[model samples]
Each structure stands twice: as C-alpha cells, then as structure tokens.
Target: MSSPHIIVVPLPIAGHVNPLVQFSAKLVKNGMRVSFIVADYYYNRVMSAIAAEIQGEEDCHVGLQSQVKLHSIPDGLGPEDDKNDMPKLFLSTSASWPAMLEKIIQEINGSDREGKVTAMIADLHMGWALEVADKMGIKGSIFWPSSAAFLAVEFSIPNLIDQKVIDNDGVPIGRQTFQLSPSMIRMDTEHLPWNLNNDLVTRKKVFDFFFNIGRALKLTNWWLCNTSSELEPAALTLLPNLVPIGPLMTPYKKASRQHLSEEGLSCLNWLDQQPARSVIYVAFGSLTFVEYKQFQELALGLELTRKPYLWVVPSSVITSTKFSNIYPDGFNNSLRKIVGWAPQQMVLSHPTIACFVTHCGWNSIVEGLCNGVPLLCWPFVAEQFYAKTYVSDVWKIGLAFESCENGIVSGGEIKNKLEQLVSNEDMRERCSKLGEMTMKSIQGDGQSSNNISKFIQWLKE
Candidate 1:
C-alpha cells in the first residue's frame, strides 16, 4: 500500500530540464511520488518553480504535498564559474555528478518507504544516470529530449566509424551525403553536428559526448522520444524499444492565456492586432550563438519581406565575441518586434502566428508543429541540423536556408523564402494538416497518449 517513488534526473540546460519537469508533473498526476534531481547552482530556481506550481494548485486532499521534492547534487562549479560556458559546465558535471548521484541513491534507499526508489527517469543528456540506477538495482529509462533520429545517430556512432563515415573521435572522415534509411533524406555530412564547430578541441569533446551516450545506452532498456508517432516513423523505427510519447508540453486545455512578462504582454498585444496567420515567429534556441553579421542579414531579410515578425534574439548575441558595431540600420522602423525571452508555446499557439523562422531545435519544432506552423530553418549547431533535415526534407513541412559564400544567410534568400512560404497554399495546407494530426496523436486514446500511459504503467509495475 506504499506509494511509488520515482527519482528524476534533469540536465542543467533549459531545453532538457523543462520537458522533464513537465513529464514529472504528468507522473505526479498519475499518483507517483516524485523527486527532481537538479544541479546545486540551479537548486533555488528549480525549487521556486516547483513551489509556485504547488501553491497554485487547488487545495484538495493529498494535493502534491510531500509527493514532490528537490534533491540537489553538486555540479563542481564555483561561485565565479561562468554557468553559460556549456562545455566547461558539462565537463564539471561529468567529473562530479556520478558519485554524487550514487550517494543520493544510497540515502533514499535507507530512508524511503516500502520501495526506496521504484524507478528513475533520466533525461537523455544525463544518460549516465541509467547505469547508476542499474548499479542501485532499480528500474530506469531515458526521456529523450531530441528527435528519435538524433538518438539513432548517437546509437550508430560505432557503425558509422566502421563504415569510414566518421573516425574513432566521431569526426566525419572523407564524408559525403549519406542516407540512414530509404525514407530518410540524404544528409550533407559537413552539416553533421560535430563538424560545424571549427575548434578542434570543442568538436572532439562533442564527438566524444555522443559515444559516451552510446556506452550509457547499453545499460538502459527504454527510450521515450519527445516526438509524436506520426512525425518521424522512420527514425523511431530505427531503434527498437524507442517509444514515441511526446509533444510533452502543458495540456492545451489547461494552459494559461495570461502573458509571461510585461515584454510578453506587449508582444501579445502586437500579435493580437495582426490578422490570423499573418505574422512570422523567429527564434533560435537559447544555446546557439548568432553572429552579428548573420543577425544583420536576418534583419534585412525580415524587413524586405515587409511582414510582421516576432523575433526572440537574446541580448547575449549583442555582447558576444561575434558582435560588431555594424548593426542593421532601422529594423525598428519595420514591422518587427524583438524581445529577449518569450513564452514560446503561448506565442506559437497564438492565432496570428503564420510560420516559424527557427534553428529547428526539437522543442521549438514540436511546439511549432503542434500549433500547425510551418518552418524556415537556419540551423546553428548540434542536433538542430538533423532536425532541419527531417523537417525540411523528410516531413516536407519546412524550408532550410543555405548559408551564402560569406557563411551568412543573404537577405535576398531570407526574403524570397519568407515570400515563397507565405504564398504557397499547398505547403500551408500541409502544415495545417500535420498540426491537426499532431494534436490528434497527443489526446485521449491517441498514439502518444497511449505510449505515455504504457510507460507510466511500466514504471508503476
């Protein structure tokens, strides 16, 4: 008669943690006790968010009281550590978290009721936790935050090396375009995630990261993708035991209509004033850096289109090493509104959003797809390029911009693509249909809902 207790490990990154937090909420709703494992520096922020959610929930019996808790683990970061330095932070966590996690498991085992820990769900970014759970003799599974294709690629790193497509370090060697499946679009090897980085050390680190994931994967049995079943059939089919239980966001019916911030409110007001499906929503995921030159080109393109746009360009870009004094003159005079952080799901759900101009991060792609907006993809780094290949080529729901000779997207290319996208009725119709299908798959008795339910049942068992 004891409650089921699940330990959930989340990576410090926003994209990784947010979906897992949402997944945790869903698990709590299904009557499991949950503990969110977070990095020490992020402890206060995570606890605050959880407290807000708890305080906001209705005062019903056994209402999330003692059912959720935050467990902090040291990431080996100092007060002066630059948290934004991803590679540094990751290396720090890689050295410290495993032993920290093992100790946490022992403590919970000695203190918790009936089952010390019934199961542990780890984000794919922290795949090493799966082996830790195995060492602790508990059930474990990975909640993949990226596309199934991305995971499949990681899983096949060995095969790729054997075939001479990539080396021992995972750098593509003498690479050309290749296909993983007949239905999969041929991918340009140069655009592969690892190759994009010019820094040899950084590229090697990233390359090694995937192989580390492959090693951890051998200890885990289940992978839950953040994709709808209909979206990437080939990719899901690429690996056995990969289940589609996704578009893992807040439920549409219960989502807030309120704006996230004053800036968000202003953006919402602007969106409200536009005609339905008339404004473009542009954003690159938080981690990707956009150089000033590229940013200027993007502004020019958006201005040339003469269409209303909501652009979420982080202020970090303005302060980055790539930044220059050369600003695109007079972007404010055009039909555009730029802000820092955006309430993306709410924005995509807005009636005025026509299409998304994006870097094609998995979370953004799913959010856009769920809202039925097609895409204009300009991938920057990491799994985003794979996302671009699938969305633009396999799914036929978006367009990908090719970088010009200057390694910047020309204003002309951006303008022409935006014009072509908006005017193409067939593409629009397809987007609308795909969105409808996505909506269907995540509802009652739908494929995604069923998959998630099955996974929950497995965890409970």
Candidate 2:
C-alpha cells in the first residue's frame, strides 16, 4: 500500500506559505506524501521558507523534503512585475491557477510517482482550489492560517450585511463599533479587514474578494485552522468545521537551531551579547510599508528605548518612493542593529529577547506568544487591529501603542509602551503561561495534536 497523498496550496505570501509548509512537514512526518504547490514566481521563496521551517526538526529534517514534492504553477506575472500590488496578484492567480492546478492534479494521478492523490488542502485565501479538487473527485479542506477569531469574524460577513453593518458593496453603513459575536472583540467599521484601505477602489476590490470567499466556504466540509481550541475557545466555538491544528512552528531544540541566512546568525550573535530579557526585537512582516515620516518616528523611537534592540527593516525600504532615506538623520547608534530580515522563530526563542515590537500580523502574534515574549502592538491594516485586541485585551499579554494627532505613533508613545510592556510582571507571567500552553498543544495528546491525528486518520481512511 502507498502512503496517502495530499495537495497543499497556500497564498503566495510569507505568512501564509510558512505555516502551511510547516504543516506539510508535519504531514510528511506522519507517513503521508504531499504535493506542495506555489506560484512559479514565489517558488524560491517557498523553498527558502521550507528550509527555515524544518531547520529545527533534526529527527525528520533529512527525509522530510523528499516526502513533500514541490510544484510551481505560473502566476501570470513577469520578472519585473510589481508583486506588492496585492489586488493584482490575487486576480492574476484567480485567472491563471485553476486550469493549471487541474492539469497538475491530472499529471500527478497519472504518474507512478506518489500514488493517486487522496485529498487537497488550501489556504483560505485560495478557496477556489477546493472547487478544482471537487471536479477531480478528491476531498478538499480549507486551511485558515491565522487566528480562529479572525476567521469567525470573516464568517460573520453575511450577518454583518444583514444587520446593515455593511451593504452589498461591503461599504460599512457608518462609523460604528460592532462585534461579530458577544464573546469577540468590538471593532470599528473602519477597521473591518476589507474596509481599512483609504482608497475606495482598492477597498472594494478586497471586500469583493472576501465576499466571494463566503461563497467558496460552502464548497468544502473541512476547515483546518492553525490554532488550538484551548487558546481560542470562544472563537472556535463559532466555527464548526474549522478544526484547530496549530501554533505550527519548528519545534524548539537548542542544539538543532539553524539560521537560514547570514543575517539571522549575525542578529542572533548580537542578541547573545545583550543581557537576558533586556533587548527589544522589532520586525514588521514582509509587506508592511512604513511611510517616510513613520519610519523616521520608528527609528527615533527605538533609539529612545535606551536598550539593546534588533530591528528587521528590509533593505528594500530604502528604495520605496515613501522614503528619501530609511533612517532618521544622524541615527547612527550602537544600541541597535538593523537587518534586512532575521530568522524570526530563532530570534523569538533567544534568551536575550525581551519583547516583540510588531505590526500585529497573526504569524508574529503567535510566534511571540509561543516564545512567551510580550508584544507592543503597532497595527497597520486589516485584521491586525483585531489581532491587537486579542493580544492586549483577551490574552492580556501585550499592549497596543497609542497614536496621537495625525495618526502618528510618536517616539514618546513607542517608548512608553515598551516601558509598560517590560514592567508589567503580571502580563509577562500571563504571556509565559500562554506560551507553555501553546507549546503543549502541539505535543503529546494535547488538543492540537489530537486534532491532527484525527484529520490524518480521516485522510488515510
């Protein structure tokens, strides 16, 4: 008998691809074969992310890559195309991928290679893949790679519309605070994941995309989420098919830690010299563009912290039209080190790291909590505001930065938040306790582990 085979598709973003690939590695370790697909343009990135994810999985690292086949389909974008135009990328993939995926499915089933494909799993953003799988007679599941609460809010879109929170165009009725569920956080209409963009045209495009996802939700029965019931009991309660199977990370093993880039190693070495729990680690994920004014404020803010810090400001920031210069003038200082990127998981797990100053991307949120590092939330857009709510309100493990006039989180505000975050012993204790629970959920017979076993059992059957 051949090992059960599955096709895994993720949206072509680092946050989406990273967790899904890490989950694919989990499937590989459990005696299954996986066909991991990415856009042709992002193939190298997917591979790099996979290499980083498995770096700590020493016991399974060698054979793991072999079990998971990497497949790339054309994204219909050119070498010089601006991939940062998200609406364009989303539409391009929708236009080009379905047929390509169908072809790939046929080719895999026809081969003697990994046996007939048994199931398909895709990122929630790539919901249309489930339809392609259904046409080919395979079971399909949608994977929500972020917070379960986030998905719950998305799932409530129809309700929001019915309640006149928003109309058919996804334009909110007015400026009002609303909660998807009584147990969930109250959010401003302006902060609705699809409504945050100031440009009406782009906002509508994004809202339409998510509106279509609501339609796509009906096409599948299984929804795998990268979270645990213990961590989000109220949120998971609202999602019947959304199984909790995460906090999926490269399990930490001190001797097996490997840095994927030289920058990562250098950053870790800098952390090594800092006093334990005395350094602030700041990183906004791949796509966050800081405005020139905001960038200067952030740079100066970090300087004001008067403590050792590691800030991962991608070098590309210097090239953005938003900036004439990426750093504040006369900003040369030994208290900080700036890098293009850092091996995030490794950095979070480092002893000298005191707090995470983040943009509240869900991946960053989970990683920070998993390492027991409290966060200074600096949300920029979309579901991030809600994520901030979870960290600072529901979880009580972090604090959100307050912005003054003109929406600038001033240097003093940043410094103040860091000071508050570091000094709150109760918050630190809560974060540490949450981290232990998060780690446990993926090990032994914890809820997440059991959920994974159940899903695999069903797949094999």
Candidate 3:
C-alpha cells in the first residue's frame, strides 16, 4: 500500500504536544504524509520544529520537504483573550471546535495533499474531532497523552455510576471505596480525578469534560496510548482496541537539554560530589501547582532529609508567593541543586540520584522508570493520583506519600518517605529490573514497536 496522508489534531498543551510531535516524526520516517493541526499561537514555531526534525531525510519519500504540513485551528484567542485561566481557555476552545471541524472537512474534501486524507490522529482531548473523520469517511484514532489506566477509568465511568460509587455528576457516594476495575486500585471517592475535593464548581466542570469524553471515545475506531503494555498490563488489557505503543521517545532527548545546561551546571556538579544513588531529585511536572503552604512544607521537608538534593520548583511558585523565607533554618546549607526547572531526564539519568520525589505525571514516572530510579510519589491532580496508585501499589517501583485532608503531603511525611525510599535496597533493585524491561519493550520488534508498526499499517489500509 502507498503511504497515506494523515491529519493529526493535537491539544495545545505542552505534555500533549511533545509526544505527538515525536510520533509525527515516526510517521514521517515510515514515509507517510502528515497534516498536523495546530493552534495559531504555535503554528509557525511547530512548523519550523517539525520541518527541522525531518530536514535531511526523504520525509517518508513524499519529497525533500513536502510530506508534513501544519494546518491552523483558531483557539478563540486574540490580544484580549484571558490566557491566565485554563477553564476560560477551554471554554474559548469549545467555541472554536465547530469552525475547526468545518475547515478540516473542507480541506479533506478539496484534496490538495498526497495519498488522500486517510486518517485522523487526534489528542484524546480533541475526541470531538472524530466526527470530522466520520463525515469525510476516513479512520479516526485517539492519542491518549497519559497512562492507559487514565483511559481505562474513563471507560469505566458508567460502571462506577451504576455501582453507586459515584453520582452522574461524579461526586462520590458518602465515603465509598470504588474500583474502576477489580484488578485496579480501589480509590477513595473524594480523591477521584473528577473530584478536586474542595471546589464543587471546577470539579463539576471537569466531570462534565470526562462525561463528554466517555461518549466521544466510543466513536473512534482505535485508541493509541502513550504507554507500553509491559508497564500497565492490566489497564492496557482492560479496553478493547487500546494500543499501548509508547514511552515513544528519542533515547538521546537528554543530550538535547543543553539549553538548561547553565542553570543546571551547578546542580550537575553537586550531584557529582554526592555518593552514587544518595541524592533525592524533586520535580513536579509543568502543570501542577501546590498551595503556598504545601510548597513551604515541601521545602522544609527536603531540608529535614539532610540529604543532598536537586529540586526544580517552577518559577511560578516564587511569583505567587515568596517561599524562601518559609523554609526552615539550615535549609540552604545542606546545599541546593537545581533551584528552578532543571532538565528532568538528565537529572533522573544521573548516577547520584536515589529516589525521585515526583508529582507522578506519566512522563515523569516513565522517565524515572527508564532510568532505574524509584519514586517518592506525591500526586497532585487528575490522572496523577491514578498514576500514583499504579506506581506505588501496582508496579511496586515507588513509595507513596500519605497526604493530609487538604491534599497536602507535609514536610514530615516527605522526610519519612524519602528516608524509607533511600534506605530500601530491595525497591531500588526492583526499579532497576523494571527499567531494564521498559527499555526492552520499546526496542526493535518489541511490544511497543510492533504496535506502532500495526498502527501505521492501519493508517495505510
């Protein structure tokens, strides 16, 4: 079969975009034509990036450079749009969806690209775009950005409601314990992804968002998760047509983290000074935010560890509140490494690192696992809590923090978990074994590689 032209829809968020961008390069490598639908805000930048990614290659034999195209979708953002608030940004995106759909349909019908527009690969957040493929009589698939467990839970929403574990609005039924599947972790109702615990209005909105996804996902022909089956066998097997084809990453992505080399040089030097596997590395992924008090507690907690550490507190934390003064005495004297935003993959791959104190974002977990580092799991929001369960309970590669009612993992708790994780030789050995297995799964002809090949074949068909 000849290579097919594929339309890819990506959520504008960084986590979603980063992996899909890498996947697009794979499709190009396999000699397929790709039209990546991008928000105008990032169009030129993405175009340049992807173009550079395939520059010397044949671009899947389409031409020297014509195989990949960037198509823009208005995100309802103008000079006046409020970019600070995400829900408002989401609402603005909802306003633009219909127009985006119409434009894409028109583009496909007009037929300017090569091999015909055969399929759409959309970020799961853009599940509604499946209708565009349906109207055009083409295949549609979802690129889920998080764990397969996250998708599995969304698939089981109906059962969760029927079991009286959660209401239609997704509020839990009076302190009940609910399992999305019998094999998965049993979770407290208040900690469910749709429940923010304290904010009813935002929680309801998130619930509604998932309610739409639960329906929208049924229309797609296939599910492509950014995880490997070896990592989450139960969740990967839970839903039909769910393909775990990832941790799809370039092995040398860390070598490219040179842009942050200067801010992180001192940290690297400090890591060199520590004994092997003796330092704790703390970084919450990009999107998470702890309240100022929690931030303070976390800072002090790291100090109490009395162990050398590298912590990447996003600069935004300091913007909202000055947390430095709140840190306990002797905090800076133990010596700081990576004050704000270190290159995560580099830090994880470092020999001096023992336990990763992480927010349990799927990317962070996978990276840590690939590097053979056990985690001190402190989940913040959404599927991160689910990831925490799979990490600590299911995968056994991590130790979870006991959080307070306010959802805060206090300083004392942090110190306790860090001590235990650093002291646990058995867990470190297990993490090393799992990391080796994860690497094998993504190598040539392994599960993820095979699934990706099958997905590409499906595109051609």
Candidate 4:
C-alpha cells in the first residue's frame, strides 16, 4: 500500500544530473517517492536550481514549502579540483562510491520511514553502483543519459575488437571506412572515439575496463536511455531491456520564455529576427577545453559561414596554461555580435536555429535531437566521438569534419561542413522527422513513457 521509494544516483556532470532530476520529478508525480543522491560539490547548484523551479510555480507559497530531499556524498575529489584531471577523479570516485552508497543505505534503513528504498537507478558511467546495489540486495537499473544510438556504438566495441576492426589501442587500423550494422553508422580511423596514441598500457586498461563494463550491463534489471525508441529503433532491437524517457527537461518547459539576463535576452531577440532554420548555434558542453588556436579557427569558421550565429566559449576554454598562446588576433571582436552562455535548450528549440556545431557531448546531442536541429560534429574526446558517429552516420542528419595529420580540424573545414548541413534539404527533413518522433516518444502512449510506467510498476511488484 505504500508508495514505491527509489534512490537515484547521477554522475556529477550537469548533463547527467538534469535528466535524473526530471525523471525523479515524474516519479513523484506518479505517486512514488524519490530521493536524489548527489556529490557534495554539485549539491548547491542542483538544490538551487530545484528551489528556483519550485518558487517559479503559480502557487508560489505552497510550491516553496514542498520538500524534495537531497542527499550528499563525498566525491573523493576535492571541491576545487580541475575537471581536466578526469582520469584521476574517475579512479577516486569509483573507489569511494561503494562506501558512500553503503552508508546512505544504512542510514535509510535505520530511519524507519514508511516507504523505503525499493529500487536504485544509477548513471551508466557510474559502474560501481552495481556492486553497491548487489551488496544491499536492492533492485538496480542503469540510466544511460544519451541516445540509444550512442549506447549501441559503445556496446559494439567488443565486436569491433574481435573483428580486428579496432586495434588494441582502440583505433581502427585500416584506411578504409567502417560501417556499423543496425544503425549503418560509418566511421573512419580519424574519428574513432578511443585514443589511439596513448601508451599501450594506459590504452589497453581503458579499453579493457570499458569492454568489461559493457558486458556487465547485461546484469542490470532495466536500462533507461535519455532518448525515445521511435528515434532509434535499431538501438531498441539491440537492447531489449532498454527504455527511452527523455527530453527530460520539464523545468525548462515550465520556466518563463524570457531570458534571465539582459545579455542572453538580447541574443534571443536577435535569433528571433533570423529566417526560420537559418542560423547556427555553436557550443562545446560545460567541461570541454579548447586550445586558443582551435577556438580561433572555430570563430573564423563561423565568420566565414556568414550566417547569424550564437556561440558559448567559456572563459575556461581559452585560459588554460597550455593553450594560452593559441589565441587568434582580434578574437574578441570577431565574436562580439554573438551571445555568451546562451540558455542551450531555449536556443536549440528556436525555429530559426538551423544547425549545431558541437563537441557531441551526450546531453548536447539529446538536446539537439529534441529540437530536430542537424549537427556538424567536431568531437574532442571520450564518448563524444561515438556520439558524432551516431549523428552523422547512424542518423543521416549531419556531417563530420575531416581531421588532419595533427588530428586537428581547421576553420575551412568547419565552414564547409556548416554550409553543407545548412543547405541540404534532405538532411533537414530527416532531422525534423526525427525530432517529431522523439517528442512523441516522451509523451502519452510513446515507448519512453510506457517504459517508465513499466519500470515503476515492476518496482512496486
């Protein structure tokens, strides 16, 4: 008779946490109880966002009094840590997660609450959650905060390795292009997601760990993807237990359309004046750092495109010590007309925005797809390369830049890709259809909504 209680643990990144929060809100609306577990460093930001949303509701007094509990766990990394040191942070977090989670479980068990934690949902990248849930004897699910297409590509690494298509260094050894079945995604050696140039020991360990984790995915009770099945039928066939429930941006939908600041608001007004589907919106996700030269090239490329554009080049991206000398002459003036720190969802959803030049981070990919905007993939590192492949090759909605001997792409290449994506009507139509299907999947009678319902029902049972 009690409401089902679930504990959700998301990766520390904003992309991961945003969807988990949205999903938790939905569960709460559906007569279940939810507990959000976040890392200490991110607790303030997450809690602040939630508070702001609650206060913005029409019945402000009642909404502000509503309680959604947040639990914090130490990330094992310090508060001021640089994100670029992710490998070190990953190891620390992995080693610490089990203990942190166990302690939280013990406290929950002792609290004598009416509805106890019946299930656990963790970010897929947070693999250590499996051990914690197993030890606690709780039902466990993994939330893949990306498209099922991306997941399919990640899952196929072992097969690529077995076929000798991907070498031990995680690079494709042959000059020929490789196409993945099901999605029919094409990939070349230059675009491989894995690092081919790292020392053999480091490269081997990274690949082995990822491969083992992919195999371990089979042990989960359910898989939740931040995409709709209609958008990626091929991925659903490959992952039977997978569920798509997303766009996962309820708060954004509920918020006022007006920008929170003068600068961002001005940008939106400017965007409104552009022709429908004619502008380019460029951003690397929150954590990407680009050398000054790369940033300059991108700026120059955008200038050459001569299209109205909005770009977010974070101060961190340009100020790194190693990349300090890489800035282009008169860089600030070149991008003076564009917006900075643009509200991503608002920008993406605008009808005037035609294309995205992106780093292909998972959340950004989902946002772009939800808006039906095509991409010009320029992935930097980690999972981005896989995402790029899905956008350009798997979906037929975007294009990839040619990489050079230094593995860097130039402004000329960026300009060419932008022109191609913006001018191609077929690509635009496909992307639009994909967007409609994606929206449908997250709503009534859609596969994603049904999957969430089923997941909750199973928890109660």
TM-scores, all candidates, are 0.89, 0.95, 0.84, 0.83
- Candidate 3 regions with alpha-carbon error over 4 angstroms: 1-3, 40-74, 77-91, 101-116, 196-202, 253-275, 322-331, 403-408
Which candidate leads the pack in lDDT? Answer: 2
Ranking by lDDT: 2, 1, 3, 4
- Give me the runs in candidate 1 sitting further than 4 Å from their true place: 40-66, 77-89, 106-115, 257-259, 321-326
lDDT (Cα, tens digit) per residue for candidate 3, span 339-360: 7756566678888888898888
User: Between prediction 1 and prediction 2, which has the larger TM-score?
Assistant: 2
Distance (Å) between predicted and true CA of 351, model 4? 3.4
Model 4 bad stretches (over 4 Å):
49-67, 78-81, 84-86, 112-115, 153-161, 166-183, 188-199, 214-219, 247-254, 257-278, 321-327, 331-340, 403-408
Candidate 4 C-alpha lDDT tens digits along 13-53: 77778778767766666566677888787887677555544
If the candidates were sorted by their TM-score against the true structure, best first, what order would they fall in? 2, 1, 3, 4
RMSD of each: 3.2, 1.9, 4.0, 3.9
Candidate 4: minimum summed lDDT over ten consecutive residues — where? 56-65
Name every residue pair that clashes in candidate 1.
none
lDDT tens digits by residue: candidate 1, 1-461: 67778999877877787777777777777788887898777776566455434433333234564677888877777887766666665567777898988887788878845258889988876788888889888888888887887777778777778888888987778758777777765666676655545888977886787678866667767778888768888877777588888877664334444424577678877888898989989998777777667778888898888889999977777676544553676656457888886778778888899889998889998888778788989887757888887778777888888777778889999999998887777877787788788878877888988988988888878
